[model samples]
Target chain A: MSKFKKKTATSQEIPTSALPDIIFMLLFFFMVTTVLRETEIKVEQTLPKATQLRKLEKKSLVSHLYIGKPKQPEVYGTEPKIQANDVFINPDDVVLWVNQEKDKLFEDERDQITISLKVDVETKMGIISDVQQELREANARKILYASIKSVDRE
Target chain B: MARSKRGEAGVNSAPMADIAFLLLIFFLVTTTIATNKGLMLQLPPKPDPNQPPPDINKNKRNIFTVLVNSQDRLLVEEQPLNDVTELRSMVKDFVLNFGKPDADSRALYNSLPNSMKSQVLRDPNSSDHPGEAVVSFKTDRGTSYEMYTAVLDELQGAYYEIYGDRVGISADEFRDLDRKNPEDLAKYEEAREGIPMAISIAEPSKVGGE
Candidate 1:
């Protein structure tokens, strides 16, 4: 009976050391396998007010396009040519730039593409229409326009 | 030698380590990196607050309006375009003729400048007028995700054809335009910069058929 008890004790001791190593390896494995979320561009666009707003799914691929006042061209001299600085054009240029970037980002057909257009409230319809025209030209089919939910002025 | 032969009743520690290492390697090999996708539309830099706002309303009439309702219908000035191809051609004509010196007949300008020659020639500073199309799209609020994207795709395809043709490179060759000569690359980049893809929204009217 004494010999039987001694044999059982030795068997338990072997597993004790192995248990901690297994747990540690598992923890490390999970840490390494975990995927981190990606960062996206943050810009303000006026979203239309809605009574119901749907939450997007976790894996949805959404591309962003923002339209606002055109930034002044970089000034070089003390007295920069104000004419160059003052010239404001449509958002078509920005769209073109975005399309080129999108082409590079989504080279694989397996990945889904979504375009979110964020336009300022006061911007004319013509500018947005031109953007849509450009999107069609670029073969970017999925599009979402962001608008602020309207509030009653009263 | 007699003691070594006495007992062999336990699993070896080395084998346990080997198993742990194998499991670790399996997990490492099986893990996949998550990826995101979509059309990367470049936004214009913000306007300097000190500068006065441009008069967009004054030129609204000159600008063509293409509405993509929540239903994904394409309308030009309230009239539906025949198809995506027609819309593209119409927009190409409009953008190409925007600031020409000839003032009298704007509509006739579309026919005068035969599209074949014009599509192949691109000005380095002419992103705004890529093949004569300047279109603005207003999407309704209740539009479905699929419809909105389809409309956007059609519009982008048109622009792509115009820009692609003007650059005088096939899609296959143009794909590597970035990796080509520095001057050609700069020309491509310059032509691409500052273009707009602005989309606006209005209070969605309960229109029929999405």
Candidate 2:
């Protein structure tokens, strides 16, 4: 009777110890297989409000251009003599950067290019128009303007 | 070391193994994995009953249809354009020479008798003189957004030059000015209302040429 009892107790303990190992294996599998979503740049733009906005079905290639305050110029003296920069400048530099990196992002097809402009509401129309003009010169079509809907306050 | 026959009599091992086998098979069949690819575009669908349809078919001769496929080639009507700059010239010529509206229609239609005015009311592909020129942009699926936007910019620039507002007036300013002066309002109405340069966008039938 003692021997039989000892055998039963050992069998129960074996499965209990194996439970932790099984759990660890499952966790590892999930960690390795899971695909993380791509990171998107954050831009401040007040989108035109539309009640009938629909989600896009087909996937088009998009390059993002963020138009906001220009970077502060480097100061040389105690009293920083401000050098004037073009206030209404196009995001041509960004476009050039995107074009340089296009090979990695876009496949062999040329027509698949899409450029989305994310411009702040305060941004002048000239900036947007200039950027659009540059894009035209680049022979890039499939343009979209990105805007966020304003939330209604109570 | 000898087998314990007395305790083994009640053991039923076959059913437990069968259950484990069934569980494995269930998981194997149910599990699915997918890979994410490409950009997403929400296309405008056919307008609802309340929405007015913009006439897409104006004069066939003046109407320059540019189709940008998912591959980024520019097709004029069905033929590919050799150079991109040609688009601007084509649009310029069409707008400049848009013929006068018919005398009967001018009298019967709204007060504005300008070609630009008539063009706004006419379909893009309409064969009539003074009919508005239509520029149709049909993009294929999986096409990049950057390319499409560039085309739009080019078209807008061409229109802006012809309309005499290199920096086009804002919508708000135009609306405010619309109510103040009758003469200015008429000109604005004629420019804005008549077959203004129309842009229509369409998607290809299939994705990625498949």
Candidate 3:
């Protein structure tokens, strides 16, 4: 009985000695990774992984086009959706939206505008192709297919 | 009571950890990990409605066509390909082919080291030079986005591999080269002088697709 009590009772006190250090470390990690999202993402997105990826530069010149299924499938239905500015964007309005986005930028910088396509991996190409066609009509020629960087060959 | 009655009592430190915890929780809740990186592509300009399309003739040997159907099955250059990974080396081989070398390509070929020179298989039935090689990537409307991106990644990886080999650097290092740095820019320019990464995304066909 004495041996067991001595062995198990060495540190009954929950060690608060390193608690502050752990908390500070976590705080620093969060601080470094913190990118306050400008708008809430309404659709579910799981970015495809790729070994060959280039960093998208100049955020001001980049326009985002999100394609994925709605978060609440029961309410929004199962059809894949396109989103921009945290709102559901209709396929028909893509061209108009792109043109409007282009207009928001300076005329000289407009030529360098790149549309980033953040698409869900499981999404069908039909809607994406339609959007591409619409983007062509809008004259937004440059596009970036957003992918998560991975070291694995897969 | 005696310790508390001491004139110089140490300040309490019990609440310090709580303050840190609060700050940590705030940061964790307020932000997210944002990633903005991808494979960049240029779409073909909108075609003129009235005028006839330009009739530019390209040799059959120079075009490397890759097709992805609704089922995500690949058909590469008239042959059905099962695996996507095989496309990298195949594309690299096609781009490096010096079948009917012109004066400019001949000069470029001569500049290559003997080791690399031996590797360039002179397939007469294939592309004459890197400049002439055009990869036309086509997909069916029902193809999944995952397969599309995977194919694009392989095609782009092939170009990067060629560029890296030309400049005697690994592809990853070449990618990391600073565009703003004059020295790095010069090296990149030399690597890509004759070979432009020319990948054309053809309009997706509606046949056998949703």
Q: On residues A25-99, what C-alpha lDDT tens digit does candidate 2 reach at each position?
A: 555555455544242223333333321122222234555555543333242222111111222223555445446
Q: How close is chain A of candidate 3 to the true chain A, as a TM-score?
A: 0.77
lDDT of 3 by residue, B1-210 (tens): 877776877777678789999999899888766677898888889999998998859999999999999999999999999999999999989998899989998898887657567779889988989889999999998999999999999999999888888889978778777888999999889888888899988889998666
User: Candidate 1 falls in which docking quality class?
Assistant: incorrect
Q: What is the per-residue lDDT of model 1 for residues B6-30, given as tens digits with 9 covering 90 to 100?
A: 8896767666666666766666665
Q: Where does model 1 exceed 4 Å of error?
A: A1-154, B1-33, B44-53, B57-62, B81-86, B96-115, B118-133, B171-184, B190-210
Model 1 residue B195 CA deviation in Å = 8.5
Better of 1 and 3 by DockQ: 3
Return the TM-scores of chain A for each candidate in numbered order: 0.46, 0.49, 0.77
Cα lDDT tens digits for candidate 1, A86-136? 232244554455455566564774234566665544343444555665555
TM-score of chain B of 2: 0.49
Error of 2 at A147 (Å): 12
Per-candidate TM-score against the hidden true structure: 0.39, 0.35, 0.87
TM-score of 1: 0.39
| TM-score for candidate 1 (chain B) | 0.53
Runs in model 3 lying further than 4 Å from the true structure: A1-29, B1-11
| Predicted candidate 2 versus true structure: per-residue lDDT over B13-102, tens digit per residue | 445545554554554454433212112232333345587877755446656677776566788767787665577656655554424556
* lDDT on C-alpha atoms for all candidate structures: 0.47, 0.47, 0.88
